[model samples]
Structure formats: C-alpha cells, structure tokens
Target: MNTKIYCLEQCFLPKNWELLLSAVKNVAGFCKESGKYDIPTLPVKLGHSLSKCAKVLRTKAIMEDNEDVKKSVEGFLKLYEDEWNERISVKARQTLYDAKFN
Candidate 1:
C-alpha cells in the first residue's frame, strides 16, 4: 500500500473524518516534504498563510509527482476562507495572535 494513502487513512480525527477527506480531495498531492515549506506548523499562523502557500506548493508537488501534506492543510484553509467570505460577505483577515501547530 502507498505510504501517503496509508497515512491519509490512519491520520485525522474521527469527527473530522469527512472534512478531512473533503480537504484531501481538494489537495491531491500532500506529503512531508511540502509540509517543510518555511511555514510554521502551528495552527494560528499556519491558518493565516496556509491557504496561499499550500495551494502553490501542492500544485507544484502534483506536477513533480510528489505528495506534500502541507497541501492538505491548504485545502482546509480554503474551506475556512470560503465559509468566512460567505458569512461575512467580506474577504478579510479574521483571526488574530498568529501561531501554529506541529
């Protein structure tokens, strides 16, 4: 079995199972290498820059035939961005105290 496939299956929370899959569908290439891209893994800071950087990195990784987990994070970021934009009717930064997760 593929390592990425296995990890994608084993990892993620039970409550977020569906959301995670939805996230993975949006981000096809996700692996540790792309996860190392200069962004903080912490939740807050990661959420802030994740959507943009993850999209670019994941797209590149897919082109290179490599999987990058950061891409998955990017998918989640986009979901939140879309939801927020829908609710507030504004494209703006909503979070504060930028930090991260590891």
Candidate 2:
C-alpha cells in the first residue's frame, strides 16, 4: 500500500503535494485512536503503516525540495513514534484491558 501510493504520488501527483500530505496525515491521526472496540494492537499496526507511508512521502518531499511537506511528514513520523513509544498511564492501561477482556 505504501509503495503503491508513493509511486502514484511521485508519478501522477507531483504537483499536488497537499493531497499526498493529507493522505499520510489522515492515516497518522486514525492510528492514534484506541476506541472502545479497538484492539490494543490496532494502533500499533496502523502506526507501522503510517510510518512506512510517511517515510516514502518524506523522501518525495525532499526530492521535490518542498520544505513544508517535508516538515509535515516529519511531524507525522514523530506522531507515529509517539503512538507506540509513549508510556501508557495506569488509568489508560486499565481502560484498554477492560475493553479487550471484559
């Protein structure tokens, strides 16, 4: 999925940086959620995908010499890291456990 989108963005959407950036940002946001029915690993899976997508987009941004898009991709990459790297609060951990097991 990341490779396909990257190819299309690179070959077809070269002048449409906003759309390309938006796609990554949308996925990045979605991957941050831990909704009622979401499994504990949901965010991790989506975050991994987001990381892959963002890395490719970052490379494309660099190739295009577009600092704004590059910066945005970097931000998304940071978000991807935070999705899994942040330590869970005790309260939040309880909530997640209940959601999955109860």
Evaluated with TM-score, which candidate comes out highest?
2
Q: In candidate 2, what are the lDDT values of residues 1-102, reduced to their tens digit? A: 333454533422334343444453354343335422223444445445656877898899899999987877776566545543443222234456886686
Candidate 1, residues 1-102, lDDT tens digits: the string is 222334432232233434543343334322344332222223333344444554666676677876454455455555656653332212112221122321
Q: Give per-model TM-scores.
A: 0.27, 0.46
Candidate with maximal lDDT: 2
- Give candidate 1 regions above 4 Å deviation: 1-48, 67-74, 86-102
Cα distance off (Å), candidate 2, residue 100: 10
Tell me the spans in candidate 2 whose CA falls farther than 4 Å from its real position: 1-37, 87-102
Shift in Å, residue 85, candidate 2: 3.0
Go through the candidates in order and give each one's C-alpha lDDT.
0.39, 0.51
Q: How does model 2 score by TM-score? A: 0.46
